[model samples]
Target: MEEQQKKEDGLLNKEETDTLHVDQILRALNPRGRYQILHILLVLLGIPSAGFQLLSNVFIAKRVPHRCAGPPDGSGWSDIFGDTGNLTIVQGRCKLLLTDNSSVVDSAPCVYGHQYKMPENASVISQFDLVCDMDWLARLSQSMVIAGQGVGVVINTFLSDRFGRKTVLVSTSFCLLGCGLAVAYAPNAIVFVVLKFLIGGFQQGILVSKATLFVELLPVEYRSVQSWLSGCTWGFSMMLFAFIAFCFRLRSLFFQTYENDSFMDESLRWLIANGKMKQAQKVIRRIARMNKRSETTILQQIQEKLVLRKENGAEDSERPHKLVGQESCQRLSLLDVLKVKRLLFNSVCLWFCW
Candidate 1:
């Protein structure tokens, strides 16, 4: 037990160039190291990505649902929401037949909160009134999630090349945390729409940085395992959604919409990973209580990590610089893509007749 504790705390006092085992990776990724912060940033960046992939499935599975789908006079999916709750495959709606008393309802404020409805409502299961219903907002959120991830990929690439993986990671993490909450606090529809795009763009940057770190940290032999781990985590996340849907029913399982209105809901895990250690520790303890696990060891592990990190600061300064100058590094830019595009178009025009 003493040896294991010493092993976990030894990274700072010494630098070993040996191959890393799964235990090493877990220590780097999970317990209380900056690596934990790195991994959390990487995974949370994936939230929007996973959110994007999951959104289409969400839309298809449940069409524009409403609180009372049919009419206030009726109850359940049909009675409460209306015929619009009915799934139509023609429009890519899920072939779901809500056998349960409840059909998925459009919980968007504009639709669900509307005091007055046109006597002849034209929206089908696929169509939610974009003008009134906040469904557009939700859609926008999903788009931003994707867009942010895409942008994060590019920006993080530049960051990786210019800065060390750790620096870029720190930048991306703050961006993600800030942008995520900004989205939650968007004042009106327009703010929500525009910032959502920005958030998606930035989220992509974070992922690129994450991949660089993960790949570099792995021994070449087990790099494939890193890939597998990513795939497995995503698959696991899908199952998480399934569990949420099953446990709470679909209403409580939206990617963006949750009863909790604050930014804390945006990322409880993130709060802990990024220097909010005490807060994160508190959250984890609560989780431990819920799982009926003994957290005494976990708390001790965290303490050891904090101590190692302090020692690590001195260690980093003692090492000679092993990296290159940014000036010589090729920083790919959007302009480069445009130049390639123009060259391709000119070549095609010259060689082939329209």
Candidate 2:
């Protein structure tokens, strides 16, 4: 009779347990609340910030028009600068005459510094002369940032899972801020490249961790809406970034604060997945109290859900059933990902797309 009463009160049967308890927590918390609205906004900032940081190079590296080397001022060819006013690559471009006017000298590629047409607000490309034969160096510089982001995704995934989402998010945000400031004052291309790589790594770390927190915190039904919300934020920020690119200098602008706030929660799903059931229940109870659900009933539902998950062998198959401790919660490795067939397949596809 008591078991029948438990079933009547929305507890899952032993045969129907699943590992994901987020849906239950969301049900108790109410998907559309002040907490959720703020939480979503908090986590969704990653999309826009990532867009701005990645695309800033376009403006920072904008090409500036230039002209090749010219003869010394004492040479009779001083009239050359006056003759071709603001016109690059004239008929006698890079041509130098000997003091006796007996022989013509051809200027080598950028032997003397090229004269930039625009004196004010010159891009890094113009300042560093990253054009002509050295154009490949510019491409390499931009690509290094993206390569760093790829490495960061793998690293942050393990870090966030092992140390908790909040730790990774906060640390990476500070990293982004520090590296961004450093990039603005980078003395040379080498410094800029190194800083840009760190920017990509930190930017992606915050992005991945925050997005994971956002999705995991919301109910399954609301995740679709949340996806659209995040996409819209990205689109709006991209347009805003375009405007800022024209109106303001990329280095002078600071957009790193979006990743540094404290409006998110430690992921309950992560806690449960790592066998920290007590912590997961505590978080759920707090959420239940805030959302005005019956804390006892919700806790019962969570237990029933876990019991059902055990019956179907879902949780055990996902992770080995071992005593909860440092060993059980050891950091997930790349090999662990490869060992799983579905994960390996998904990873391969993601790599191709990335």
Candidate 3:
């Protein structure tokens, strides 16, 4: 009886080892299959839009040469202010020299609105009359975009952790599209700034979620290659953005919308870690099908692993509930970094470098 029991235990251990080998399954499916290539390409489509949005203010808030409107009757500058003494050209841009009824030349603000050398709708500086006293609004708008990105990083990180990465990525992408379109047709400065803030937020969220998904999709050995590929894609996108901005100017903002059709599956590691075995199995099957591999074999292995895990989970359930609950409650916060001296020093150095 003792010899028979030993043989059965050995066989069970061998079966567990065979079924729980994740790397072996990955090798069998071929990590560098057509599905991975296509997925990477599709995810990269959003990089150019991100670059365009980041640098768009350089064109959208561009300063154009302008002077005060002469008169409603289409009078020229020389015709309106005749025989004026030499004034600084810079002063002439904001303040207009006016000859009152007493023949005394006095400087006044651009009372009748400004006339721009370029198209009236060329930039926010000209379109919304943001020059002279209102020029600060243009700078504020640009600053607001950067501020929104900071705020987005925090909020989106939390949301991505709570919800899945794919869900946040798709939602943020659509939100970004809507914000970009709305900004193009904003009626006033307040509305424009508000939309820009939201745009910055959504843009950051998309970036973070996509990056996490991209890394998760790849194997450990190819992560370095993945980083290089991502860097190259981003660099190329930025260069393309520069050319597009040159050719299309502010109109390019409207053309910047590129829809992502292929939604990526959730991270398999995340699903397994969270005990979502059914969802993990579905993702595995989909991956196998896309890679043109035998889904039945991989699914069988995963199903066996799932059964073993469930058996172990049942045994673990009665052991210790209080310790697990307490550990879960002690969540890490940003302030925790300061608790470690070495970590705090490294963080400060990285901040300065950035």
For 147-172, candidate 1 gives per-residue lDDT tens digits of 66666666667666654555555565
The top-ranked prediction according to TM-score is: 3
lDDT of 3 by residue, 1-354 (tens): 743453333222222323344454566567898777877887787677876787788888888998887667754455535555553212367887654445536666665788888876678788899988989889888788989999998899778766777888899988888888888878988888898888889889988888887777776787898889888998898877667767766642544566773467776655544445567656766777889987755545545554766578734334332221122336556677799788899989967975
Q: How accurate is candidate 2 locally (lDDT)?
A: 0.67
Error of 2 at 64 (Å): 1.1
User: Can you list the residue pairs that collide in candidate 3?
Assistant: none
Model 2: colliding residue pairs: 17-308, 17-309
Q: Which is the better candidate, 1 or 2, if ranked by TM-score?
A: 2
TM-score of 1: 0.41
The number of clashing residue pairs in each candidate reads: 25, 2, 0
State the lDDT of candidate 2 residue by residue for 1-354, as single tens digits. 865565345443322323444466577667676666666767766677777888778877777777665545634333443343333333232332222234433333444556666642357676567667666666776798898888898899889878888778888887888887777666877787888888888878888888888777876787788788887998899988877776665444444334555545678767755556556656766676667677667656666766676687766447443332334346556897789899899989978975
lDDT, candidate 2, at 338: 85
Candidate closer to the true structure by lDDT (higher is better), 1 or 2: 2
Candidate 1 residue-wise lDDT at 86:
40
Runs in model 3 deviating more than 4 A are 1-25, 74-91, 98-105, 252-256, 299-331, 339-353
